[model samples]
Target: MRVLAGLIVASLLAAAPAQAQTVFAPDDPGSSGQPGGWVNDQWNFLPGTGVDAPRAWGNLIAKGRPGGIGVRVAVLDTGLAYADRGRFRRSPDISRFRLARGRDFCPHAGPGEDPCDGEDAYPDDPNGHGTHVASTIGEATANAIGVTGLAYGATLLPIKVLDRDGYGDQQSITAGIRYAVAHGAQIINLSFEFGTLVSSARQIPLVLSAVKHARRRGVLVVAAAGNAAQARVAYPAALPGVVSVGAVTEDGCLADYSDSGPGLDIVAPGGGDDALRPGEPQCRPGVALRPIVQMTYAGSKHRFGLPRDYVGTSMAAPHVSAAAALVIASGILGPKPTPQALEQRLKATARDAGPPGPDQAYGAGILDAGAATAP
Candidate 1:
């Protein structure tokens, strides 16, 4: 019986090596895109909303002397997929994109071997969230394909740390952070959050170390406060030396779901109801749970071959990321501004939203891309 059992165990171990590995690659974004000014008379700012309009970042960029013109910003998300409609404008010369690196932290999903597999050297996203976020930060612009980006002139280095489900383990997240810094990425944007606080505490040393290392290398790390809407903060974003961002409405109001605290460095136009009429119920045909306020990207393609709506704190995080790039590109702030100094500059120049001064509800104020870039 023992010999028979041993033989079965050996068989199981040998069969594991035959399993197919999963992989991903970046693909060409669809032809149509937003022009970075205004879509449908309103701004389609958040990810997955799919309306492609000139985002607030556009106004900010226009006012800037010429920010993020020659910089590279790394967007660490699920993956990127350029869309069919003009949700993000294209620029053949200035906007250079690559499926630099990626990993699959989810063991159950499939074998993690996309980029390394050679079958798909670039990471392409079927989920759509990463593509929307990337479009806002650094999609190729003015190619008459998609919507305009916050830093249309900047180059985007896409890295995939999370899986299609939009969740990743700490090890994978840490690896992604390090990889971005190792590459030529000067600005790092992380829009996802994890629930474990103790894990956050455990990861603090590594997170801060990476931040310091990146800063020493003239890189900036920007992350999002958790979308829980509770006062509780999440990892990486909540860590010291990292810039944690919050969300606000178009009228310059604090978003109810945005986390608030000292960690809340600055607020930005995350999303609001301005795109929809008050009584008009923001409904997306087949989706049952309509977001009271649409903020995040729903998806790139739908079952009916259309876009979907996405609303979450995750949606609010990218606006700040783009703004940070502008600050770096402006040359107004000295190169390698400390996290505290960058926070101070942003707050000092922001258009106050909450009470007069820094309050827990709104922090310093909503981010003013224009003012942050003004000489």
Candidate 2:
């Protein structure tokens, strides 16, 4: 019995991946990809970089037709610019996929009323949050333009649920989900979350019902757990059936600001404020990795100009959403995978991180797109 047990342990040890491998930026993202962007950074790839989902998963993406094409992902946040300002825009460059017409549900008639005042005829992200999240989801990757996105083949629908102040009520979010579900969005990326923990009860039926509606329609909802720096996850993420995500640094650990607990499903490279690991600098280049990179709006005088950076589970959630889009587009899971099926694939294929099995910190594990999309 001792000899048998020893053999089993040895086999297990041999199969395990190197836990503390060194991480470094790739010499180049590609001939088309430029440096200084988060997705182009080394953390998005290589075994030991942060969440451990390498961009090598992209090799499969190149061998086949672009997978995310025809898959529509709704960015239920601020919005995206219809016109080109700086290097970001919703058309021409990002025109590979068809962008669905979006709407605004900002309430002028109070928290949950129908007499809401919609902003523009088209979606526009003034606060820069929605634009950043949308770009991370799909930003015309490898087009010899700007930074790359994980699923550049996916179409983005800019549903403006949050206002210029980056604040939105329950009704707006509820309305946004319903709109996306009704309009045929395969995935809904909800990077915004309530600041505090809120119960999903009858009083909050609109938002809860909307999430339920999306699930029923087979639309995947990916959300940020929150930035509370504690164990409690906030609402939307706290609700049932949502894909809750937490943030991690580029060194394969949870960020100091990411929220965790019952709701978190997985983690992604959201970067850190002052990340610490063996043989790494205290801060990334110019507040870079501290806040994950994406093409966004900066009012004036900012890095990346139209393409800047931000730190939070907000950044992390979209990376997961992008991975989901990649999986759906890859056709590896089948032609039309139900939301539940896709979610299961993600959980099953995720690289195990933190304590073995599922834990709040890393959930099933950091998302492994390559394995998830593998034949």
Candidate 3:
């Protein structure tokens, strides 16, 4: 299911906390000589509120990988702007990324009564959702174009399970998961969710089996908790062995629209208004916060811009996927870490938030890439 985009009016005013000794200042083109202008818009990477990405960048650089080099993350969504085929064009920020061969599972409708073709080699995004999600994980860094990605050095594998409208069937999603694992993807990011009505695991047995297959193959699966704003987390994310992620705003509280329950594994910056909770200082009921900003389609697939309407658990899941790639590349977990080990490392290093000690709202806590990859 697609989480509807919302507009963000306010800008972040808080100064980021002290950064690490290794500073990474990249020239930002539109900021008018302001070095690393990405810091102004990408509050999700800041020190205090968001996942301190600069520290993680320094840690990865110290290991000589720079940004999760040698790791592969598969994004299963509505395709991506990773290629230039026919009328489609690649996103400018991610033009230099190492993208693996992707498959298009979206079915094409035939004229009259002809059979539909459901598979293709080119997975160009007709919808911008997949491109936005992929850019967050592997958009090029220090290229002086747009915002930096979290795991910029990693290889991205785009698996188009969802169609143009951000909807997909069980068969396509299952195929996409298996395809990701068999094609050498170390991590898979599922930024879409089934409806909350499909509560039980029996409802999606094929998708469940696919998730288990990824786990058995040593591929980490990260999924988004639905944006239903309810206590129950959605399927695929709620499935066992999958890292279920919830959403938090820039204020560090659970986002008003993020789902929370026993199944949630962690939280990250999803960017929206705060949920009103008693005794929580950051919970502002009506105040709209800044949404996650990345280079994506402006109106058509041919044009690109940094739009401020993207938000939801869909935006939160990629942070964990990129962080997992960083953890693998950092060498702190040894050469080949198991999926369980990577999940535990992320949970252990997260900064605590909401109700204390792994509650439903904040899960283990907001994701801290800096702490997870610290040397």
Candidate 4:
């Protein structure tokens, strides 16, 4: 989804772009300045609380499980990093990687390398957000360097749609979706989102056409609900036939900053509005998508040497995406389930989260990775 600075929308608009201050720097590792530790090292967890057992999807990846062999997932974000080659080495086969054949629509903002690639051109991410997100999905965990990905053995296809600023127009996003589906991305993870709605009747055709194409292709699109915290919604996630995700705290309570509305299809662990200091209740069962526990490290540094805690719903979406890979790999789920069938199976089996039932606050309920895999 989105993270907010708690300022009124009007005030946030008035502030200069420099002062607007969005926490999600897709190009950066989210550290203020120096290099941050491995992506999974930042995952937050609640004591005595963990991913649900009987994970229908996650269990598929267990050793010796049928279809536990390597699965492929397409990570649509900024771009993958060679600096983190150590992370990919854990894969049983690393040659499965495919580069984006799409064009980079983002224009250069300043005196830095272009984060967007042109004509098969590759861009270096100065910010590292996309790398972090991709690492979460397929990073070779247990390699003993970076944090473990949900599907460590799964293959990843990197798609860069957003630039260093973490912003992209609808045209670029639509193109990215089509590219992912055509290129064999069974499960599409859209961690990046825009703040506008697709309202025009003319524009509706483009979106509907894309969504229909995905469904027909048997591709499941999982998107993050905006982090705006307001009931008002944003696109792609709010679009028809897409799964909208919200965030939960370590204790399973709705993150105060998480956006809630009729549009939400599910909730996941996005993180908290406030730092989840110890002694707070861990994430409770609710209408969350699969919960991605928050991760933290002691005295981590960003590329520039700034120090700060990293968190967001962007972190949660990958958990669900990788888990889906596990499900698809299980063979029980077959090549690909229709988006509607996949969505229903996930919701029906998710452990109930808030209000003892589905509500706008939690949607279908907290995502139970283990349980979601149950045939």
Measured by TM-score, the strongest candidate is 3
Worst 10 residues of 2 by lDDT: 1-10
Model 2, runs deviating above 4 Å: 1-42, 45-47, 50-63, 84-93, 109-120, 274-289, 299-309
The whole-model lDDT of each prediction reads 0.52, 0.66, 0.85, 0.53
Task: Please provide, for model 1 over 274-374, each residue's C-alpha lDDT reduced to its tens digit, 9 standing for 90 to 100.
Answer: 22113324322222322222112333233211133444556566666777777776666776665556666777876665466877666776676655665
TM-score between model 4 and native = 0.71
Model 2, position 20, has a per-residue lDDT of 35
- Residue 169 in candidate 3, Cα distance off native in Å: 0.6
Candidate topping lDDT: 3
Clashing residue pair totals per candidate (backbone < 3 A): 49, 2, 0, 54
- Report each candidate's C-alpha RMSD, comma-separated, in the order given: 14.9, 10.4, 3.0, 11.3
lDDT of 4: 0.53
Angstrom error of the Cα, residue 56, model 3: value is: 0.1
The whole-model C-alpha lDDT of candidate 3 against the native structure comes to 0.85
Q: 1 or 4: which has the higher TM-score?
A: 4
- Our tally of clashes for model 3 stands at 0
For candidate 4, lDDT tens digit of each residue in 1-375? Answer: 221111111100111223222111111222222233332223331111223322332355343442224555666666545332322222221223423332333444445644443424443343455555655566543332323345556667666667655765555566767877887777787775555444232554565577678878888887777666767444566777777777666556667656677877777666544322234344333323222322211232122221123346566566667666666666555665666777787777665665668887778877765556655
Structural similarity to truth (TM-score) of each candidate:
0.69, 0.79, 0.93, 0.71
